[model samples]
Target: MACSGCYSVNFMAVSSNPNKPLTSSTLLTSKLSSSYSQIPFSSLNFNSKLSRIQLHKSNTAPNSFVVVSGIKAEPLKVMISGAPASGKGTQCELITKKYDLVHIAAGDLLRAEVAAGTENGRRAKECMEKGQLVPDEIVVTMVKERLSQPDSQEKGWLLDGYPRSSSQATALKGFGFEPHIFILLDVPEEILVERVVGRRLDPVTGKIYHLKYSPPETEEIAARLTQRFDDTEEKVKLRLLTHNKNVEAVLSMYEDVTVRVDGSLSKEDVYTKIDTVLRNVLGQRQAAIVLLVFPCDMFGISTA
Candidate 1:
């Protein structure tokens, strides 16, 4: 076992008589004593800025001071885009937990501003009430404010369904909120349409269910299911068409750092692929072991 503080450094013993080769401990103690005062401890890699120097004598051939520098990686800034029913919500939940990031849904933020009745919220409400899309500047302002918050600054953020248009993309850059990576969850158009059409929402519980993929556990809950007006086949088809036309343009804008994931697969499989990419971007070693110790021996767990 190697001590965290110090390890043996072995160099080949040089001597004509193999039987009486120079011993490392004897040579080091005698030769290094005077030189030690001139040798700056700060220059060696001991994993710490202030390392406690210790010399270990081992029977092994080669041993030297080992330094393990702790790496604190930069926070993640991610953007996710997908059509409705592409499972961005589910995947975002997994990503937030795994990476310790904040999830910011652009649509949710707009609604929240409206709910708060702020000046910008009132303007957004006027447009929404008239069935007109809110101006790009208004949405961008809200996003800019949200991203500047202390929580977002500290934990980083995963932006969802933002910069839907080219102008909005420019606004994002102006605000200095460029995403490190853009993840596009791509599903077949037919599959997206099928998922949307079969989806049902529980008005009371706000729980969503899919008649085909996932139905209510009991008939009683089934009775409470309601299909959203937007989930109608005609409306869903229109939405899909619009997404198809614009999604490529948005994706191309971030092609340099974009990663496309197949959302048509099982949710777990999709997430596995996503997790692998995230680990690479975050500079995590896949083979490294993480040991977590709890108080009083209550728990001792290791993860890789």
Candidate 2:
């Protein structure tokens, strides 16, 4: 590992040839010691930061794990857009986990503000109660407040369902939140309608289900399912139409960094394409493997 103060370990896997990778043959060539006072796994901490440590506990090798370290990546800013039923939630969950990012769905943030009853929330409530759309300034303020938080500053953020118009898109850039990439999940309007119509939500568990694609696991859950008032086919169609009409404005601003993904594919396939694009944006990471050892072995010098 490149980290300083890491020399306390008793048995560092000092590679004979740093350029050549260690193979099973190399392990077999040496007479392995059966009793070295094996280290526990929980005590090792490699100071090097690489995608939130991405720790993987190995079952095959009880006392060992491969440590991956590299130049820490920049705070990633990913902006994604899709129709209401385009599986944004599922993809956001995956992307945020894989990249170690904060998920900032603008709608969620606005709702949270409203729930907290802050000054912004109060104004938003007035507009909402009066059946008027919340002003762009209110939405932008909520988004900016969220982006300025410590978590967002350190972990970066996945901006979802934001920048609905050219003014909003420009406003984000003005606030120094220019996105690294703009991803559009393109699903047909007909499929969007189909997905919305079949969708049901379990209000108690807050779990969503689709009648055709992914149904309730049990009859009890099915009986408890409720569909959102906005999930009706008419509203879904209008949402899709608005998304299509205004997406060009956002795309035009970020044309150089824009990537459109096929939302019709299986979730796994869709994520594969997204992962590839995000990796490209992240670029090459200078990495090395350090043998993970517990505190008893890794922290103290062996007198023997």
lDDT of 1 at 143: 83
Runs in model 1 with CA error above 4 Å?
Answer: 1-72, 110-134, 284-304
TM-score of 2: 0.65
What's the lDDT of the predicted structure labeled candidate 2?
0.69
Encode model 1's per-residue lDDT on 1-304: one tens digit a residue.
4334323223211111111334333222212212221122223222213332233322221232211222223468999999878988778989999888989987678767886998888887776544345688789887888888988877889998877776778788877888888999999888998998899988778777999998899999999899865677777776666667777877877889899999999989999999988878776432231211111111121111
Candidate 2 local lDDT, residue 281: 84
Off by over 4 Å in 2: 1-73, 113-133, 284-304
Q: After superposition, how far is residue 180 of candidate 2 from its true place, in Å?
A: 1.0
Top of the candidates by lDDT: 2
Alpha carbon lDDT of each predicted model: 0.66, 0.69
Candidate 2, residues 1-304, lDDT tens digits: the string is 3222123222323212111234333231211133222223233333423234232323333243323322334588899988877888788989998998999998677666786989888877675444344678999988998889999988889999888878898898999998888999999878888998999988788778999999999999999998865578776666666777778988999898899999999999999999999988877321223342232233232322
Residue pairs with backbone overlap in model 1? 8-63, 8-64, 9-63, 9-64, 10-62, 10-63, 45-67
| lDDT value, candidate 1, whole model | 0.66
